[model samples]
Target: MTSNDAVLVLVVVTALGFDFTNGFHDTGNAMATSIVTGALPPRVAVAISAVLNLGGAFLSTAVAATIASGLVDSQDVTLTVVIAGLTGSILWNLTTWFFGIPSSSSHALIGGVVGATMAAAGSSAVKWQGLVSKVIVPAALSPFIAGSVAAIGTYLVYRLTRGVSEGPRGHGFRIGQVGSASMVSLAHGANDAQKTMGVITLALIANGTLESGAQAPTWVIVSCAVAIALGTYLGGWRVIRALGKGLMEIESPQGMASESASAAVILCSTNFGYSLSTTHVATGSILGAGVGKKGAVVRWHVARRMVAAWLLTLPAAALVGALAYWTAHGIGGTEGVVVIFVLLVLASVAFFAASRRAAVTPANVNAEWTGSVLPAPESKEATSWTPGST
Candidate 1:
């Protein structure tokens, strides 16, 4: 391969590599509740998530344009800037994963790019109007929206199941949880997976290989979808652990409600070209579900921590991106690519190894959650995740 082609390949590969991390890193967004409440096995959930995520990639390419060459000035962007931005985001992702914090991968990526672009070019490199409308507003609103819907759904679940037997109710809720969880998985693939597609496609367009405003190539979409799917299969046990059992006690009914609520908001947002945070959705749903239940205690401390992480995610990644931009600018493209590749590999490997200490598998996925505390289910459970509930 020619040197330029080789470097281009590396850029695409790194973009996909970030996609892979995005998948596994955010796998908890879809499966945490289901796994916690015994609605789906971790492995089964990831498998379903993988398939649906690829399927979701086919939904639209509008959001991709927002990330690529739109929100940021493509004329000011370079493959090096993209690479540096991706690396910064990846580092932030790995850092949060190790600590089991479910931060916004979407914002992290955007922050990285914004920082890198500003450092490399100037503030004018970012489209402030687009940024405020597309990303900032969504990031601020999505979690609260998801949480409110989940809270209402959870309350409605209890009210609906009031006449059911405890044992039969739990069983029925388990069944219902299955369906709701599956919908979240599918919805997650549709929304979160597309972000990576947009990033890589953006890189291609920025480099002048693909014309601006072109759709992501089928190969790009398929490869990113598959990479993320594989990452989902690998799972993000730490984040799952944090989401399912750390912040709240996820009963089957609560799990079902939260997943359904998240599914609804995420799907609608994605279709409208809004890249909302899956972490925001899932966490808000879980918290809302918890609040909906009578006597359900939300450790305000835990909630506070998550909120802190959310507040810091963008700025942290931005700082990293700025640093990455400065470092790589001195090295130029070829060497910069090498440096980024090594850092991502090392970070990924270290995080993987560290996660082995408390491995969360399909068999033990629900082990951390409370088993007998939830209310019984009423009738047939539906397998769906709607903007609020299907």
Candidate 2:
């Protein structure tokens, strides 16, 4: 293969890698409530999400067009820029996953690509207006919109069910939670998987393989869908722990409300071609569920930390992206990209090794949260709760 072909191959691979991280990182977005509320077992929740995510990927390509052309000046994007951007995004995903923080993978990818483009061709290369209107504005407003919807839903659910006995109410809500969570999973697939397809399309455009305005190819769509689905099947147990148990102790009713709110917001945003963060919407819904329920406690400290991470996500990933761009540019040619890719792999391995030290898995995913991501040591007397149990 020619040098440009080689670079394009690497770019496609890197884009798929980013999609994989996006999948696992945000699996908690779709299934955390279902798993925690006992609506679905931990493993089962992720399995269902994986199938829906695959299906959702084919549902739309509008968001992919926005990523490929709207956000950055396609004339200025290069194979190097796409590589650096994916590198930045993947690193940020791993960092947040390790700490069990639910940061925005969408922002990380956008920030990385934008940062690399700016570094290579200056701020003029980015479509600042599009960034603000399509990405930033939605990022700011979606959470509030979703939170309000969830709060109202939660209130209505509780009010309507006030007359039901505890046993029947919990069981009914658990069934509803499964359906609601499934919609969120499908919405997530429609929204998040398109992002990687967009990046791959961007790389293709940058390489002159496709016209600047070309849509993502069938191969791109299928590959992205499969990659994300596989990643979802693996699950991000640490993030699941945080969202399911950290934000609040989610009940079946609250879980259904939160998921319904998230699914609605995500589907609407996807239809409008906005690449909003599923993490932000889901987190907001969960917080709103806490507020709407009587005597429920929202862990303000944890929520604050997640919010702080959200605020930092764009700039932080951008800085890394800028640095990666500079490093690759300094080295020049295919060697530069390969060297950076090697370093990224090494960093990923290190993070994985570190995570194994305090591994979170399905077995302990629902262990009582003792104020941290890692569940406290299980006691013999600790009772395991499942769906429909008192």
The model with the greatest TM-score is 2
lDDT per residue for candidate 1 within 1-390, as digits (tens), equals: 765567677778878888888888888888887877777777787788878777777777767767875588888888778878888888888888777788888888888888889999999878999888988898888889998999999999899988997788888888988778778877777777777778888778777888877778889878878888888888877678778777866788888889899999988988888878889989999999999999998766777888898899888888888888788778776787678668778877987786665444544444335443322244111111111111
- Candidate 2 segments exceeding 4 Å error: 369-390
**lDDT of each residue in 206-236, candidate 2, tens digit only:** 9999999999999999999999999999999
Prediction 2 TM-score vs. true: 0.95
Mark the 10 consecutive residues where model 1 has the least summed lDDT. Answer: 381-390
Model 1 alpha-carbon drift over 4 Å, by segment: 357-365, 370-390
Clashes of each: 6, 0
Q: Which numbered prediction scores highest in lDDT against the true structure?
A: 2
